[model samples]
Target: MRFIFAFLAMGLLTIASCEDDGGDSVISLNEGAVPNILKVTGSNTFIDLIALESGEETTINFTVDKGQGNIASMDVVLFYKTGTTVYRTVLESNLTTFPKAYSLTQFDIIEAFTELNSAADFQVGDVLSVSADITLTNGSKLNILNNDATPNFGQDIANSAVYKVFQNYIVSCPSDLGGTYDFVSINIGEPGGFVVPGPETGTVTFTDNGGGVYAISDGSFGGWEALYGPPGASGVTLIDICNTLSFGGSDDYGDTYTISNVTTSGSNLSFSWSNTYGEYGSTTLTRTDGTDWPDLTN
Candidate 1:
């Protein structure tokens, strides 16, 4: 996907250093205590499916404990599983404008998934996992919240809200195919200013079993890196791929990246990867048919 920001004027201000204020509190999972609410909602794809099928006719109700004070805003990262593999999408929401009495609040927000084909791509049995990171404009406190095994396509599921205190959380979705078959896209976005050795460019090869399994590799990486599963399996996890590559090394931080987006069409796939902390540079790879997957070591 292209990095075309609708507001380029805000570009310079977008890249801010992540603050490590000691005021940020980490919640212990055993505490059973609730955190402040800045933002809350389902996955981006969940919202997309709801909007497309229900026409914004759905309402999510939940309340925040506030812990100590009001939460001004929050951001959430949602994950979905295709067989055993997991992909993620991000959503941001602000709820400070709402009435702040320790009661449930309802609101609507957009869940954009321009990459997926349609709402039918998801189903009921599938899971919608959520992780929220909250921030308050006035205080130095941060809340990190996490939830798993959240059911889909119902009002009861909408009523559940996982609360926490801070500005960052990571959610994991277990194996939830939802009875939909989709492809994974691989696209390399624009390189950041701190990229070393500049941006690298190459081609990615994806081969569908004509079923669900797919094999993907980039010539830049020297060999085919099986993406979905083993050479013959139907799905592969993100951890599997990262572990296969052993991303982090003592001297070669410039060889690893964090994949941000992944989408696929028929036998075609497109995904994007960004350099993390001066790690591996960025590269764009095109797909080739019938050709053997490229080697990654060279």
Candidate 2:
């Protein structure tokens, strides 16, 4: 009976040893394996995989999983170093698809590596990273990267990247005119000929009310002269006059003019403008209390 019991105990010990060995085998196979080139799919705004090159060429095979739609296009950008700096270049592939299962694509490893090496300022052993930008027929863009297990890169793919190319044009006018001032001068010409000087000058004082509205006053006229409009009431808005006057008319050629390149000192205001009569003109208005006409210097 003791022999029988000893044999049963030995059998139990063998079973336990087998179970322990099996568990250890499974763990070692998983943890010890070297990571190969991998492609995982999640969302549109995914971070592109960054790969470091070890040789002259490193082939990359990618598989798009189920539930992911047909890839309309793929762009591969290579970033590498030369001498002391890094640079980037793009490689594109024609579109291909499968129905529902995974789609596989192979890339030319050496060409990409060589291109990056030539463009980037890097040494031979410098780190190399790989990434991809993908576009679908539905106008969706995706950036595939290695670290993007979580949902990152947001929803808008077009605006996700930092680098872009654009064209910019600037249109500006002279700044000296505080705001907008029309090119105005009294020619004093009669219907038939030039009028002779009588009381050749009068004093004009301009009071800027901020928003491009000004008040004109002479000691006597007080608020009699129009500030902006068709000389109706003494104080008017500049915009009103610009909308109503004709060029070379008594109404002071009402047209919206841009005032730029302003240079002001003390109580003097000087500005230039692209005149409405297809010419450039400048003016200098000085603060004065005199009553002489054309006394702009005062």
Candidate 3:
């Protein structure tokens, strides 16, 4: 009877060790048997979506480290999706070392996308994803970002706070139109309809409101403040989307505005504005930074 009891205890232990719940919830002590991840660490991972001829370049600086070894060689592939089509280009291959420094330039990105037969050259708001086509030591192939039944790593590992492999870069035109400007405006509305101090000449400031938006020191190009008093027509801001300028948020008097006829010359920006309150002004804001204002459209 003692021998039978010992045999039953050993059988139960074996059954528990080999249990196959066949789900992600299954836990085992042999986690080390899982495939390792490729960790990337860096901060400069975005491409600025400026004109190709603008000489603007983004330098992606990051170090890739193989977690738990076993990787023989890998190919770093650049990928982007357009509509239902996914395009890919090999940026580097035959990487067999750990803690490799991956430095890429914006032109490199352009070349990769161009090589992949991109319908149109990369544009703002496009995303570029990087993945590794790894060759394991035991003669097996694995893609770091493959979404299949037998993925190289689980979500907890993929989205691991410490060990990360996936990387995504967004093509964006970062806009920064903040600082004081030489402002001038001519009021052209009805006489008593929000009168302005004729050809108002003063400096206005564009306070960055983040994400390509700015709050103007004087909403009506100093017209409201010159006539109505302090804090006149506040809460108005400029929304710049890919150099297309527009107005956002109503004024203190709940009056919305529209901008048109925007023109740029050197570092000067001029436009015409009209408010819902029947006030209109032709304004010019010259940049103090000596940098040309982006050619903006309504």
For each candidate, what TM-score against the reference? 0.26, 0.22, 0.43
- The lDDT, on a scale of 0 to 1, for candidate 2 is 0.31
Q: Model 1, range 1-298, lDDT digits (tens) per residue?
A: 0113424523543332133334323333222223444333442222223343564443333334444334555454445544554455555455344324221111222243333444455443233344444466564334343233222112211222453332211111122211112222223222343322333333334442211112333322321122212222111212212112212111111233444334433333334443333323233344444332223221
Ranking by TM-score: 3, 1, 2
Candidate that scores best on lDDT:
3
- Once all C-alphas are superposed, what RMSD does model 1 give against the true structure? 16.1
Tens-place lDDT per residue, model 3, 1-298, is 2234546866786776576665534222234222233323434535555633376555665555565446778777667754445677777887777667667676666667664433246665455676667676887565655432123554345434555465656554667788899988886453355455478788888897554668887788877656654544567888775787889766754568999999999988999988886777889998878688877777
Ranking by lDDT: 3, 1, 2
Clashes of each: 28, 26, 0
* lDDT (10s digit) by residue, model 2, range 177-285: 1222222222222222333222223344445432123443321121112221123222222211111211111112222334434555555554443333232334445
- Model 3 / residue 137 / CA error / Å: 1.8
On TM-score, the stronger of 1 and 2 is 1
